[model samples]
Target: MNSTTQATLIKVPAVTLGFWIIKILATTLGETGGDAVSMSMALGYLISSALFMLLFVAMVLWQIRATDFQPLRYWATILASTTVGTTLADFATRSLGIGYGGGSLLLLTLLGLTLFCWQRLLGTIDITSVSNTKAQLFYWLTIMFSQTLGTALGDWTADSTDLGYLFAAGVFSGLLLFIVLLAYFSHISRTALFWAAFVLTRPLGAVVGDFLDKPLAQGGLELSRYSASAALLTSMLLLIILLPQRAALKTH
Candidate 1:
């Protein structure tokens, strides 16, 4: 392929069942891993965020330089973002003393700002057009912020709103179903709907993970975090191995 062709060849994975499975598993692991470090290990949110942010930077650099979509590397980058998101949300809600509602509001604002800036700079927010380095950078930035927002939103619904983790998960899941319906039945832009669904899945995973690990008194299953994390990770690995992986096709 010529330089022009390569320039338009975005390194992205096809959207499939495997993609969604790995995404949810990664988000769930994010919750467990974040809690393991910040709450269980008593590292505190600030320290945890700092640590994961460094990991995010390292992984993102690796991801950018990669010539093609390597599943392990790409998912590792996603995992880093989710882990960072968990700690960042915790810091916003606790150390910063913003509380769940306040932290969620602030993070939502940041998410919106990131999207707005991306749209302004790129002139489009379609994932299909994320072919160049600049657009890829913006895509990841939006993802990081969206993950953080999802964490805060999950916590807000579970704690401040007293909906409990399971209920909160249900609410988010319902919203996801609605989004799917819209994508199928409505004239809404598929690109926009895709991003919206992607962002919503993070929170759904967050609440579901919390629901499994939190204490019984807190409306959780009282499961061991390590056990839950291991199970999810194993499932994700199995799916990734069993399913066929395909790179995004050249549109033109």
Candidate 2:
């Protein structure tokens, strides 16, 4: 493809093992960092949500205006979305008294509606089609909802079922493994599998984050959230720098 075509390629990273690794770390950082500000710092969910939402909006606009795929900008936006999603989900489920199940169902419904509209309007929900502003909007919106839903779902599984955080993480990790197997062994839709993995990773990260920081009395290690967030953030940055980052090739 020519330079112009390349420039118009999707402003998201190509799906690769490295991408998934970094994504999980980002989501884990989101959980820890969000809790650090909202819970540890006593900012409360509403204020934290507002702050993170503003940051997410700014990052998304910056990402949308970029002329080509910029790995740093793209990942930064993803982190912002996840952090905002964490706080927003917490606010909805706990502060609003919606409960985890209620919040998950509500966010899941929103995600379904967003995907349905995107598919109806664009005829495809593939990430490779996220080359233009409209598609980017839909892509980010879907991702935000998925992240929020993941948070609520993770909390519900861990807290409501007596499964504990590690067990909950295991559950999500197992589901992700199943998706990977289907991707290789079945004729399942690649796009659907990609989304399935994407959604599952968030919950895995969420529970893992909780496990790292929650009190021992609550089955967590009681580690400092700030330190955990810093470690996860550093790990993500290292992986991004060490691994090749390239835009997903646009598909006709």
Candidate 3:
């Protein structure tokens, strides 16, 4: 790695209320935007996934090549992953004729495999050590799989388990709350808790997004997906503009 590259490591954001709010909003926007292209615009899941995957690759390349962390660029990459996740999950569940249960199971297995391989190769799952190219690659790959898994898990809970979208969202949110408690009060491994919380947030966002757009009979507010996505996008943009996004300090 270059001297500059060695100085720049991917660090987790401070665990704050604002961070969680932005994360949930980003995930919700991911669901609505992904659905807009794949379902509302009549594009098949395969095509949508391909398009978003390409976009994700480009954004990740840009992020990885940058000398230092840029919050806008980093978050853009995150959004791309979520969009790709949505389409990939939809393809597996609907297009491939896998029911929600099967899709969730398949994604869960893939997620576990990714984590296993990553750990075997890297020896650690610490985000603080993600200063090198290989570590960053593994980090992003794990994120993609987790997001896809979240989509399927969300749908399985809402549809197959008959929990309803609102209730499913509540369940995930409650789990997130527990993670927060663990982080603050318990002596759990921070790395493990971080990944668990990160994975759970995706599904929480999915369920909340569904609850907003689905039919009244399905326990949703029945809002327009496009409008909700637009609003969320606008909010994110405004926050990015208003907040002070500083790069991580270079370590010796």
* Candidate whose TM-score is highest: 2
Number of clashes in every candidate structure? 0, 0, 0
Candidate 1: global Cα-lDDT? 0.85
**lDDT string, candidate 2, 1-252, tens digits:** 864576556799889999999999999999999999999999999999999999999998998898888888899999998999899999999999999999999999999999999999999999988988899999999999999999999999999899999999999999999999999899999999999899999998899999999999999999999999989998999998899988888555
Off by over 4 Å in 3: 1-7, 11-15, 247-252
Q: What pairs collide in candidate 2?
A: none
The order of the candidates by TM-score, greatest first, is 2, 1, 3
What value of lDDT does candidate 2 attain over all alpha carbons?
A: 0.92
lDDT-superior candidate, 2 or 3: 2
Worst 10 residues of 3 by lDDT: 243-252
lDDT, candidate 1, 1-252, per-residue tens: 764455435666777767877898899889988888888888999999999999999998888888777777778899999999999999998888988888888888888888899899888877766777898898899999999989988888888889988888889889989988998899998778888888888888899889889999889998888888889888877877788876655454
TM-score, model 1 to reference: 0.94
Candidate 1 vs candidate 3: the TM-score winner is: 1
- Residue range with the least summed lDDT across 10 consecutive positions in model 2: 1-10
Candidate 3 lDDT tens digits, 111-151: 88877887899887777667678878888888898888898
